[model samples]
Target: MHDHDREALAMFIDYQRAQNLAATTIANRRSILTTFARTTGTLVDCDPFTLRRYIGRDARITAGTRRTERGALTAFYTFLHDEGLRADNPALKLPVIRVPKGKPRPFTAEQIDTLLASGAYTRTRAMILLGYYQGFRVSSIAAVHGHDIDLVSQRIRTVVKGRKEVWFPLHPMIAELAATMPNDGYWFPARGGRAGHILPSSVTNLITRAKKRAEIAERKLTPHSLRHAFATDLLEEGVDIRVVQELLAHEHLSTTQIYTQVSEQRKDAGIRTLAARDIPTSSGRGAASIAA
Candidate 1:
């Protein structure tokens, strides 16, 4: 990158920091911007067409990643234009990125019961409970401190994704787990970790091990599945999506709505009428004759 581009990148990073964006968000923005500068020449020089072609150049990148790249580019160009460094925001003119809609992979009801009833309170169990029962992110689960547990108020405080500090109602199950931890520092401590707590990935690995211990079939089940289950099961029980959104601390209702996709069970139930009804065949036979 030229000196001017480097200076602009630094300025944009500082702007993200001042906006109180999450560290990872800032880092990703910086990375995307720096990568563009290194691989594609000057950042501002690329028009919308060039930028679009560049982002689409790699077929291996998933649609979600492409969307993220588009967002990062848009933000950067907007920053440059607003700062009077660029005449126009080319990235802003980029077309919308379309991502395929996939149903949320919430644990099945039987699986949830099996997990909840699995005996003993290990850190992994606690982490799973925090996500399922408390609707916490993996990072929040790892960041839980002894002091965050206010037994009197029946609430626990933690910083969630996006650096949003919020308190969750201390689910009785979580309280039981918290009671076993030291009443200071990180509840899930890692001595070598810079944050003095377990890495989020480490927490995820623990969940994976516990899933196996629970005798679950090893597949694509992720730690976030518990969070999905938390949202899904509640909605299945007729809890309002808005309430689920609040419980999940989601910034947008649209995000929360992703979990509202029709489940296979519901879809099956809906289509049963089609199965039950008999349609006459060309031979004027009803469904029973066709089965023969």
Candidate 2:
């Protein structure tokens, strides 16, 4: 029976939960493990070479993703060893790639203005607000079934993937609009139920179309840029980094520190202002004129 194999997978998932692994991380590993178990019909000994060959099949996956796969496989084997199914963890010999560092690309104020102005009503408004004002992922915004909004409180109760529930306060105008959003449908309703949901793909398409219409440059203009712009905007407004981190629900302070780089631009603007101010002109003839 594959029942024993299924039980092993369940125990591994349970262990991950106990360790406080994020929902996104657990879900991904679950998918990978299920795939492996189904393909092999058992949870047996797996070596580094076999795992490498499995991941090498996916061209679009990054080095980080491959590393995650390795970690998941190693955990599974460790579990098997503890249960006396295997004595050696073969994946201990595998080498994983290092993660690359990159800065986030943020949208300019002008581009944000253009994007907001491009959309007509609900969909456009909701999307723009979600990205800029609320710092919501496209998936979270799209998952906003009607009940999640609390218009009177001016907040949306969002169940963030791999994170705890967060309440996002709306901008005054967005709050007003949200009050009028349909009671039995999506906030950005082109759909019907919780299951009748919008995909991130659709949201991307909408942003692309809107960008073309607004004559905004397509390069580095993505749905996630809205979140970047939101963080940048908060920093420029003199909001503290820790505060922004809480608002974004970021678990790490380092993740929130990226906004500090954006805050430095504001300091530069202040320097430019100081340079632009005209100093009062001094009269060289003042002492002589007073004596006369």
User: What is the per-residue lDDT of model 1 for residues 154-176, given as tens digits with 9 covering 90 to 100?
Assistant: 99898867787888788898888
What's every prediction's RMSD, in angstroms?
5.6, 7.0
Clashes of each: 0, 0
Off by over 4 Å in 2: 1-27, 30-45, 50-63, 66-87, 119-121, 188-196, 208-219, 270-292
What TM-score do all the candidates reach, one by one? 0.78, 0.68
Least accurate 10 contiguous residues by lDDT in model 2? 188-197
TM-score for candidate 1, residues paired by index: 0.78
Q: Give the per-residue Cα lDDT of candidate 1 at 113.
A: 63
Worst 10 residues of 1 by lDDT: 275-284
